[model samples]
Target: MPLVRIHLDTDRTTARRVLQLHREGRIHHESREAARDQALRQGRTPAGDPVFVGITNGRRDVQLLYDVEVYTDATR
Candidate 1:
């Protein structure tokens, strides 16, 4: 997917540059499902498609990607 980086500009040149950067893996990405799951947990979905997400990082500062149970040494 070609994501628009409005921070640069909305022109076609900027769009092309963003695409190039994305192809070079310079763009950061996260799971849409993760975002959706986190949003849904807050009682609303985002403006895009809905999807099921696993234990992705909700607490960005903690740098943890699993459930709290896993972090607390609880067995699944």
Candidate 2:
């Protein structure tokens, strides 16, 4: 199963909560809908702050690299 990396514009607290859930194996590698459901249960806002950032096509390492690139580019 592919990994779903959800990026959020919310505060660190909320983002950390969601990341923790993912790391703890609570959120399975299912559809995006499943992730959204888990995130909601985990206290993520449904408005727009905590939104789907990106999805990895079974390339977790590459996803990290891409994220770093995007972040670096955005900082410029």
Candidate 3:
């Protein structure tokens, strides 16, 4: 499946929150830009610590695309 990577500002809390929302099905979109725009609209601003929101088939792609740490070791 194609993936969408959403770039976010530096904020661990907000980043995780957005990710959580996506995982929980609160946020659903097929495109990266759409997800990013929706995230921003939901209050995840691109300010200090930049984070990335990604929609992918798995977490590995998300980690690579966003250069963010993820807990996928168990899956591997």
Candidate 4:
């Protein structure tokens, strides 16, 4: 499975909720679709293309940044 990292433009509440759903396996992989679907299901509007909820501190916190990696299993 590939790892997808998305920076969400959200606050602590959003982060907590998303993280919870993610941990509970509610979303499908950390891909864009998963995030978007999750947000939609929650009655929230997703940004676009791969939706990500990020956080901020001083000024802007949350954002949308992703990192994907492919993997394979082999048996000899």
Predicted model with the maximum lDDT: 4
Instruction: Report lDDT per candidate.
Output: 0.32, 0.36, 0.39, 0.45
TM-score of 3: 0.30
Q: Write the residue-wise lDDT of candidate 3 on 1-76 in tens digits.
A: 1232444333444445557766786632223344445445544443322233452333333321232222232222
CA error at residue 21 for candidate 4, angstroms = 0.4
Instruction: Show where candidate 2 strays beyond 4 Å.
Output: 1-7, 28-76
After superposing candidate 1, which stretches have Cα over 4 Å from the reference?
1-30, 49-76
- TM-score, ranked from best to worst: 4, 3, 2, 1
Q: For candidate 3, which ten residues in a row score worst on lDDT? A: 67-76
36-57 per-residue lDDT for model 4 (tens digits) = 5544554444333452333334
TM-score of each: 0.26, 0.28, 0.30, 0.35
> What are the clashing pairs of model 2?
none
The worst-scoring run of ten residues by lDDT in candidate 2 lies at 64-73
When summed lDDT is taken over every stretch of 10 residues in candidate 4, the lowest stretch is 67-76
- Predicted structure 2: lDDT: 0.36
Q: Candidate 1 has which clashing residue pairs, if any? A: none
Candidate 2 local Cα displacement, residue 24, angstroms = 0.7
Candidate 4 Cα outliers beyond 4 Å, as residue runs? 1-5, 28-65, 68-76
Model 3: per-residue Cα lDDT at residue 16: 56
Residue 67 deviation, candidate 1, in Å? 22
